[model samples]
Target: MRGLTAGYGPVRALDGVDVTAERGHITAVLGANGAGKTTLLRTISGLVRPTAGSVHVDGTDLTAAAAEKIARAGVAHVPEGRGVITELTVEENLRLGALLGSARKRTERTAEDVYTMFPALAERRRRDAHTLSGGERQMLVIGRALVSGPDVLLLDEPSLGLAPRIVSQIFGMLRDLVRETELAILLVEQNARSALSIADVGVVLGLGRVVATAPAAELAADDALRHAYLGF
Candidate 1:
């Protein structure tokens, strides 16, 4: 997304934000509450309308397109909450995501492929979604998104409220997925340190604007930046 600007009513949640997520890499978006992290992903995925700027996946312009159209373009978003259907079984929810992905080549990814990536979900494939634990639910949502075989995956607050061990495992798997599949991942996390630890690059947002964009290592090493914007 370049020069992306968006908000609700008159409030500008994002202001002149320019960002990129490359294939085979993970770009982490770090910020405090209300710093436009969620807005960035929403605008890119067409959930929130952009007041200005353009959103593109590859060379195709997706600026202000409908959410369904964007999804068909192979840009999948897994929002903050683990939003699996409580009434459906694990495999049922996974199939729904594939269907939501539109008429993409289904052979690109399968329920078995998702099961391989997340064995925990595979274990309870027939169980109700609500019966899974918090960490398991997080895995399920991510796996569901992956079933679409998206070129770019937008994740919002993936680590929110999870235990440290589970967070580590999930983040590590994301890193492996990017390396192996050459998938571009845009990760939004309030856990700045953890996000930077696994990210190839980091973008810091402050009050509806981008404060800095740098290599994750450089941002992690900057004490002043960490203290001021990251609050770590």
Candidate 2:
């Protein structure tokens, strides 16, 4: 994105922000609460229109495209709070994800691959979504997003409200997914420490603008940065 700007009426959520998500890599966006991390993802996903500038994916401009168009273009967003339908069965939710790829022919590989990646989900496929635990719910949502077969996965706060062990397990799975599929991920996270631990690249946001952009290792090792922006 170049010179991107977005807002709610007069309240600017993003101000001339510039960022990138390279193919076959994970680019993490980290910031404090209300720092426009969610807005950035929403803008890229076409949920919120940009007031200025452009958003391109694989050289195609998407700043003004519809959300469905964006998803069909292979950008799947697993929004904050998981957004699972509590009334639906786990399998049903997975099926809904398949609908997002409605133009493509349905195949067993899609569901099987998601189940293989998230075995816990497969085990509870018959259960109602509301019955699952927090971590399980998170897995379900991510699995649902994967059913769409997106090239770029936009993950928002995947670790929120989960225990440390569960968080580690989920992130480990995500890292493995990245290595196995070579799928690009743009992760918006508040847990800077864990996010940086798995990120290939890190972009730090403050007051609706980028404060730092660097390799994960470099960002993790910077003491001043850890103290100032990351709250470590």
Tell me the alpha-carbon RMSD of every candidate: 1.3, 1.8
Tens-place lDDT digits, model 1, residues 1-232: 8898999998999999999889889999998999999999999988899989999888999996899999988899999998989999999999987887646433477889889888998999999999999999999999889888788899999999999999999999998898888688999999999999999999999998999999999999999999999988
- Candidate 1 has a TM-score of 0.97
Runs with alpha carbons beyond 4 Å of true place in candidate 2: 102-109
Query: Worst 10-residue stretch by lDDT in candidate 2?
Result: 101-110
lDDT of each: 0.91, 0.89
- How big is the RMSD of model 1? 1.3
Displacement of residue 32 (Cα, Å) in model 2 is: 1.2
Q: What TM-score, computed on C-alpha atoms, does each candidate reach?
A: 0.97, 0.95
